[model samples]
Target: MIERRLFEFHFANGDKNGVYHAVYAYRNPDGGFGHGMEPDTASPESQPLFSIMALETLDEVGYLTKEIILNDFMPYFQSVTTEKGGIPWMFRPKSDYPCEGHFKTVKEWAALSTTAPLLGILEKYEIDIPWMKKAEQFVWSEFERIKDKHVFCYLCVPRWLTFLKYTKNQDKAEETINNLKKWILVDGIVCKDKADEGWGLYGKPHSLNYATSPESILHSLFNKETITSDLKELVNKQKDDGRWDTWYGISEGTKLEWAGIQTLWALKVLNNYGEIEK
Candidate 1:
């Protein structure tokens, strides 16, 4: 059960029809139980950012069984779909071109969504396994092209583990485990400050544009997992107040929603280490 304070945005104004008079765009059309706030740009919900962030939350807080979905999330993606069904970027759709998300094919699309992660952590949650062979084949093949980018972050772990788990590819799993360290900002994550004036595959971080890139994302990625003393140092920095400002600025505006999102994201890493959940 979620605290009412955190959940009222969806239930507070809901009608007898089960629809909330308020609009949470990422929500199912009926305005049923879901994880995001209103999706109207004028409101705090402009970015469909919460869609994945929410899935990540549900991923952590043991709520995905009830929240998260393709139907509910697809409208946002549908706005961007180019063909029968394809998601270029998980956030920006094909229509937002130049501003569109990357990964041109449907296989690429699944990599961007929780589809990969959910499947990876499935057995951990006691979920089913179907068509795993095809799923594993697709993700590993695609990672070779985008491993340097955040796109890789979404699927690398899952794909690597998939090969190890289903295909019994120990050699490949070892390779993935080796590279997993590099993916972590072990130090920090780097993102450009603003949207580029011209088009590119993805966007960059805002604050650290001038000083020189530091390790924010990787550091954050490993923040909850103390496999190394460096990660323990970073996670320990969480304020007594129970928050860590992705302060280096990789997630500036996102700080507003960072508390819940990062808290849960951090927990995932920690859980990976067999540490007890806080």
Candidate 2:
């Protein structure tokens, strides 16, 4: 239902309300979202990861309003937030529904990987609420702590990039991007060649996965040839059934759900780079 609505919204001149309705079905009474909205876990309990997916969907459909941010999202985040004012990647699932083992093993501590992206979403929408300041503080501290590290987690790089992309502190953001460049493609943080593997959920992080759009600050890290090749690689990955597949999922249901999500993502990326008509 969600995937079909997303397809229609993007490609078939469909109504955004349909997408909103389907996504809202996952909203918990606590104002957070769950029930496997992310596809990697089927836990019905409200989780930070699921809420991130939910917010991303809402943002895509232009349904993320200031009211939604202040009333629905902030309260839920406050309830789950750590003392450091950041949310954990996952909370221990209260229900026994299927969940990946890695998600089950997470400790209830603040994680920049999850928190930074949420902040990025808020930044992108220019939505400022009281809770955002604390999140920003925590994310900045994490960035400072990790800047000198020899390597970075592949997953965190894009989230951090998203935060930097929309962050108000352009000077600091530029400095951080420059500092991180040495480790980005050089330390194998991002995949420059097509053969690099095992560095991401499905494979190594493609150049497109980092830069996302031509205007993104991360685009400076890749050459024209690299982006062009990665674009071709992305286009070739689509299956005969007109959907993209995910290599990481704990269940058959999860795989199918992720396929739909990935298909939507692929279409958006192609359209962003003008590989296809929007």
**Candidate No. with top lDDT:** 2
**lDDT (Cα atoms) of all candidates against the true structure:** 0.37, 0.79
RMSD of 1: 10.3
TM-score of 2: 0.88
What TM-score, computed on C-alpha atoms, does each candidate reach? 0.43, 0.88
lDDT of 1 by residue, 1-278 (tens): 12222233232542222211222333444322233241112122223333444444444334454223444543453353333232232333233222211212323344423334433544444444343445445556655665655523332333334334443455875575556555534334433222332111113321211111123223334332223443354356456876644432113444435444445434444444444343
Q: Look at candidate 1 and tell me the lDDT of residue 58.
A: 48
Off-target runs (Cα >4 Å) in candidate 1 are: 1-26, 30-115, 122-133, 147-171, 181-242, 247-254, 263-278
- Looking at model 2, residue 3 earns an lDDT score of 84
Top model by TM-score, which number? Answer: 2
